[model samples]
Target: MTILLMLVQIIVLFVLVMLHVAYATYFERKIIGHMQVRLGPMQVGWHGLLQPIADGIKSFFKEDIIPEQADRPTFMAAPIICLVAMMTSLAVLPFAKGWVLADINIGLLFIFAMSSLASYGVVLAGWASNSKFSFLGGLRSMAQVISYEIAMGLSLVGVMLMSGSLNLTQIVEAQGNSILGMYLLPQCIGFFVFFISMLAETNRVPFDLPEAETELVSGYCTEYSGMRYAIFFMAEYIGMMVMAAIGTVCFLGGWNGPFAVPFFPPLWFLLKIYLFMFIFIWIRATLPRYRYDQLMDLGWKLLIPLALVNIVVTACLKAMIG
Candidate 1:
């Protein structure tokens, strides 16, 4: 019965996540469309509500093309690797009390490990495509992911220190009694660094050098088509969701709400996630992509040191208070 319940939960979360991904694309287009004073996907369903479904169908029936010079097996495996890594990370996120798929002690570490694994998909996809543009994009992506990932992980170390545990649930609980009841207040610098790193981690605008369409013609997925391309898209959205979830869990007090609203912790969590998603879209619409060199410099010279200092300051403050 426990196993059945776990399986059911997994399936339900999977469906919800897939739906979220589909709608996220629609949401992005709608938001960006309105921002640019144009209608987006008005012909599909009501206000283009069904556009994601239409796109899914189109992708399914599209021809799967393998480039003559491409490494067929790795090219195919890359997207699968990307999708699986993102999906697996969701298992450890606690939506609310007793609502996690896996209440692992090392939940935070698991998420970091999974996110790091996701970069392999882009790297392999670019390498296996055997295109100069794709290869260059892949190299850029690897460097970016590796650079930002260090700061991203370090930023969270402050939370782990304050909470005195690696479990995500405990981290949330720890925030309930902290100053301002959220890690964001005390770890503001870390939060800022992590938030920017999240943008880079998900390959969102302002940091989307890897797939700069104008420059690299879709980057790592240049040679991909049909369902393969769909998988890449799916992985991208899932990564966005995962990053939002992490932001909620680490900084904004995951599922934490006022005592007056204790009955609906999940609502607060969802609200925070949606807000982050909106920020993601808003930035995508507003910011220009950063030059690759500028991006690398920001990640290494600025964010990383800020994250380290935030961790040090947080630890000192916690010890002083204790």
Candidate 2:
């Protein structure tokens, strides 16, 4: 009975996440369009509300193309690997107190592990496609994820130090006890580093060299088409939401707002997540892509070193406060 209940929960969350993934693209297009002072998706439905539904149908019916010489198995499996890994991270996130799918002590670490695993999908997709552009993009992405991932992980050490636990729920509670009611005030350094790393981790603006259309044409998944192509994009957006959720939990006081909704307590949680998503779209609209060399240098020569310093400083402060 317990197992069956858990399975039902998983299915529901997965469906909700897929719906969010679809609407996120619509939101991005509309946000970017408005940013550029143009009407976005007006023809689809009432300011493009139903655009995501149309897109879902279109992608479902589109032809699935594969390179004649491509490694069919790996090519087919890559997007599924990437998408599944990302969606799994949502399991441990605390939407509200005790509302998590899995309330484990090492939930934070599980998320980090899943994120690392997602990189393998990118690597395989590029190699299996057998295109030079795809291969180079994949290699670049592998290196990019590896480099910035170090910075991102190290930056979060501060949050762990303050919370005194790897459980994300405890982290939010820790922020609540703080006078400012958010780690954003005290963990400013970590927050800054984490946000920078988040953008790079998600292959968002200023760090999207892997898919820079001017150079790589389409990056690691360049050979994918139709639903397979849609899957890769779904993974990207879901990955964005996951990172934003982490930021919310770690820095923005996950679900800890000024007031709680009487009947809908998770309202605050959803609002914070949406705010972070908007920022993701905002940056993509505003910033130019970083050059590959500059991107690497930022990760290695700057963010990592800064992350290291933040860890040391955070640890010292926590020790002193106690």
Alpha-carbon local distance difference test for all models? 0.91, 0.91
Over all chains combined, what TM-score does candidate 2 have?
Answer: 0.98
Quality of model 1 by C-alpha lDDT: 0.91
Residue 103 CA displacement from its true place in model 1, Å:
0.5
Cα RMSDs of all predictions? 1.2, 0.9
Q: Tell me, by TM-score, which candidate is best.
A: 2
Q: For each candidate, how many residue pairs have backbone atoms clashing (under 3 Å)? A: 0, 0
TM, every model: 0.97, 0.98
Cα lDDT for residue 257, candidate 2: 88
